[model samples]
Target chain A: MAKSKKNPLRWVRLDNAAKIYPAAMRKNWSNIYRQSMTLYEEIDTVVLKSALEVTVKRFPSIAARLRRGAFWFYLQQVEAAPEIQEEKSHPLCYMSEKEMSKYAFRVIAYRNRIAVEFFHSLTDGTGALIFLKNLVAEYLEQKHNISIPFEQGIIDRRVPPKSEELEDSFLKYAGRVPASRRDTNAWRVPGEKEPEGFIHVTCFKADVDSAIALAHKYGCTLTVFFSAVMMQALMNYQKELNPNTAKHKPIKLLIPINLRTLFKSETLRNFAMFTVPEIDARLGEYSFEEICKAVYHKMGYELTQKHMSAVIAKNVNDEKNILLRLVPLPLKNIVMKAVFDRSGERKSCLSMSNLGVVRLPEIMQKYVSRVDFILGVQATAPYNCGFLSYNGKVYINLTRNIRDAGLERHFFEILRDMGLEVTVESNRN
Target chain B: MYCVKCGVKLEDTEKICPLCETEVYHPIVKQEQVPPNYPPDKRPPAKKKTKIINGVVLFLIFIPLLTSLISDLQPDGAINWFGYVAGALTLAYIAFGLPMWFKRPNPAIFVPCFFAATVAYLKYIDFVTDGDWFLSFAFPAAMYFCLIISTLATLLFYLKRGKLYIWGGFVIALGFFFPLIELLLSLTFDLRFIGWSAYPFVVFGLLGGVLIYLAANRFARDAVQRRLFF
Candidate 1:
């Protein structure tokens, strides 16, 4: 049954499998593909404590799933009466330092700041970004024991994507790139020699408007500029590793494109696909004009609706191969190995994901401190960077999971040379 | 006692409750009541659907194996292990994955159906080749390692949920446990078969124990759970 129209739209998870992974949070980004959202505003710790009181007063829905036959399924929920329990945890919430990663999506907070992540089915990033921002914004504004503005509590509930949008977008974007047997011949292939463990870096509060102006001046979106800058740094690092590396031919880059607008769905799982463009390392050193043009043209072609449809078809049909479905148990592992090897040959030298522009009220900024994004790279992301914009500012979260530490330093140096003074954020995690 | 579904009481005089009329076991001299509906009941039959679907899934699963087998089948060399792999998955889907949809489901039917499938695959290999190695070596060895643990786990869960499942779980647990034990002993000290038909008495014992327990127990009338969800 459809929910009461009077009830404000809130987050709804699609499944636990999607919620269990950290990647689900990073890629919650949607773009021209799909962009569905809902928002809650003017809620602070005092008000939030009160809002939870009101919010949880509603009925709770739970999903149960069984793994091993003898193991029974368990129940979980997105919303429930918090007063009935001491704490609540969501599926996506994680602690990297913990073993087994027995993670939950919800987190409890009677006081202090809070951020929430949802798989697209629950709420698109835009909705979550806004919800979290205003949640904190309203939380801080109330901290001073001050009077509230009437409109601050206002919320805008966007309509869920239609079934037709879901069907169309799913037909376009439900594509999975099979594990390739060939190494993705990216600019530089990672090896045992690269580093001890993958490298991770975060830079926050970088004057986002200036970066936007710089990006606009160069005729590119902030995402494009940041991506270009990341690649430029990686290219310089590669040159340092081996002088001959940079002088070699251009490298290919992989960027994730959300197909939200193309196809809409109230359910969220994997709704994005990869767009890999072969970029010349030389392009990073060229004028911003050259870099911007290349990025725009590449994204234009790779993120198109038609091509995405083709990809979806290929993903479905590819899995039907009898070799994959009927391989002997003993030999199934062998086949998977071949697929993985091929993937290395096709790996992207660098990958950039821009969560796009996030807008927030001025009041929320004080309590939020800042927002951060991190990409999972078993090692060697080619060059990996995540850009999330909030309050007209962008936070560039980078990790060289597969590259050497030298590469990270080179990236920052190149940013400086590009006439951008980048202030690096201290790593908290 | 009251009917579990509708809660109408059955009387000593009536064959079944007149209001809740399901088949009654007592007097009325075993004369059958009029079967609820007239000439035809149109809830839809599952046989045709289950058979067709089972056939289709079997075909879908087998096509790949057939190809792999055709591509790799040999006289006495490199047996098409891929066929065995495909065959195992086919067995899994056909046996465990397909039953939940039926209006009526009986574990009595499902358990033995899979039990036969497991034994038949082993026989197929040995029959085509006439070597006892597949059964003598792998059967017991594998049973001891995997089935023993799985059976124990199943029993633990049974204790947690309810003892009502013992009619099925108890018999199957033995079918798995004895062979596994024999297999382990044969490998350790060495023995002959323990000989085929060695567990006839054991099977009888398991069956008798369970039957006695069930015969003494009375089932409480309770509402059956049902739901229709995608």
Candidate 2:
């Protein structure tokens, strides 16, 4: 049943993985993203707005704003519907704390697309995807006068949210094990960054079957193959840019692993930790097969339940520390901000997050044309790549703040060489 | 239609690429001009009126101030305790309330202003009490405070790296400050110099020297950082 008038507004805590985001955000950087789904027809704003009004109520976590208390930052429930805007020029634009305090996310509709950009302090890509899927379902249902059942990550807004859906999975699944992984600074891609607040988004479209065939040929999954390819591209670029320093620097890709599969928790907040898959160029140049093997094996070792649990335990243990708890919020923000800047992007050349297959109901799939996931650029790391496959098409969206197209060119050339048809799209304003 | 620069596919209505601001142009495709219906500018949620709260607090303080002023007025038409009370209230206003008037009041400016207010308050107290210690004791005390605060402020503002040296200097100065204070007190009160201030001076002098030594040596600095890695 729909949340009743008497059902009190529920405020939730920031998930364990989400605690650092609010503190780490700056004017140029707020870890935010825009996950958009394109339809064959122009978006009907009226239906989209009404659909959001109902759908957001289902996601109490996303419907809330970030609030700082004496102890920690939290999500406070907001009763009003989020303002739906026409698609602006940029995706994943900078969101200030003031904006975050008012609304942690936004919904935009333009032409054949409806995108939801979220301040990652509220939800991760999975959590955001859940909200987006529900919104799309409601939109399609209202627009076409059809009832779309909630399944495959879609939720019925009429149903009240479960307590487990709102739980902080990190705290719930934390153990005594300590995290052991450490990374040296990775090779940085050198290029002049575009003007502040401007991001260069390049979407590389390729056939899913061909990409998968290529991955299968190498005995690796799609993500592993892509990681190897990206690392290879960076290694080549580093050698091209500065061959002397290339041997000294390691090429590492920071890949976020979803922990929900292991913890058995269904919370729609951030329940993920990143594993750094690195190649030591000092050891010598690695062949494509060797790189793929390294990436596949490393990802297999790092993404295990035991390893992920230890990572979560380390983060939760820090949060649970009595001394850290006693530190004032302002002081904690300063320290966390410093730690986030120094430790976040320094050890990774770039980030590659693949959201796997995006499945929709058969009835709803007719109206949807494509889905795109755009990861925001980091402070130090200029570019980040996010891929999502829907239907037979794979969308490789590269969000970069730099002016150089060398990386993207090299990346697409690799695909083209493999006989996979590639179409490059960009928001080049 | 597509943006020529960053190359993300553009909507038919879009005049330019939203991400890179590159103008959208396609030789074959004619541009359809439909202005986007963007959401109204989100007026940053009305900020809380801290100024009004400060005004209310100032008003509350004024009531007691007025009462004190009225009570302090003697039948002989003399402003006896009123001067001290009014001076204190003025000092309180300067120290606490004045900064609220500006959006971002610079600490560099306000720190000295606060010290001036404090010194003025001390002078007013000395005058009201008919004491002659303003020059010998109170002035030196205020100067000492200003010296420490200004030194710390300058270090915080200017010194970006290797600030331990500035800290060590401040500590050493602070150590010497106690002896000067003791000498001033002995001179003013006609008390014998019992050398009590020398104890803290010696203790802090050693501490400051050790810190200075650590700041001077690169090896010692790295070792301290490793040991105190928070």
Please list the C-alpha lDDT of all candidates, in the order they appear.
0.46, 0.81
lDDT of 2: 0.81
> Which parts of model 1 have CA positions greater than 4 angstroms off?
A1-184, A188-199, A246-250, A264-267, A281-288, A319-341, A344-346, A361-369, A379-383, A400-404, B1-230
lDDT tens digits, residue span A1-429, model 1: 123366532323223222223222222211111111122322243455554433322212211111111111122333432321122211122223121112122323422324343323333343344344434433444455643332432232223333331222343344455233232366663433222232333343367778877788778887677767666655555666556643655555667676665655433234566666555654445554666677778887767666776676665454455655465433543444454445632466656777776544444344344455544342224335666766555666564433234554555555556666555432211
TM-score of chain B of 2: 0.66
Top DockQ model: 2
The segments of candidate 2 whose C-alpha lies over 4 angstroms from its true place after superposition are A1-8, A245-248, B1-230
Docking quality of model 2: it rates as incorrect
User: How much is A107 displaced in model 2, in angstroms?
Assistant: 0.6
Over B158-198, each residue of candidate 2 has an lDDT whose tens digit, in order, gives: 66777888888888988988899889989998989999999
Question: Residue A399 error for model 1, in Å?
Answer: 2.6
Error of 1 at A140 (Å): 7.7
Docking class of 1: incorrect
